[model samples]
Target: MPATTVLRPRSRTLIIAATVPLALAALLADDVRVRRQLDAVPPDPTSSRTDSTTLVPASS
Candidate 1:
């Protein structure tokens, strides 16, 4: 009997596993810049008030 190697499924699994983390890392990598920009925006006491009654209604 001759020995045979199966390559297709194994290669496919490796490619899929590698791609998942690379994609997630790319998504999370953009958050750093986003967080930096968000930090620059001054927090408004009126907007962040826990009491909804404190929020000013926008005029139509």
Candidate 2:
């Protein structure tokens, strides 16, 4: 016969409490890394150019 082990409520709570901070830290680090990479790129100069084509039909 195999023996089964069960976790107490206090143990389960402690395990969950320990993981919350680690998860938050990982998310914060990833956000900072992405923001830094985005800041390093330069903006395009031609993106502000507007189209001047006319789309009206000529009437007879």
Q: Which candidate is the best by TM-score?
A: 2
lDDT of 2 by residue, 1-60 (tens): 345667889999999999999999999999999888876767657765243233455698
Tens-digit lDDT track of model 1 for 1-60: 335755589898999999999999988989988878877777678765664335577799
Misplaced by over 4 Å in model 2 are 1-4, 49-60
Candidate 1: lDDT of 2?
39
Find the 10 residues in a row with the least total lDDT in model 1.
46-55
**What is the C-alpha local distance difference test score of each model?**
0.78, 0.77
TM per candidate: 0.50, 0.64
Q: Model 2: which ten-residue window has the lowest total lDDT?
A: 48-57
Q: Which residue pairs in candidate 2 collide?
A: none
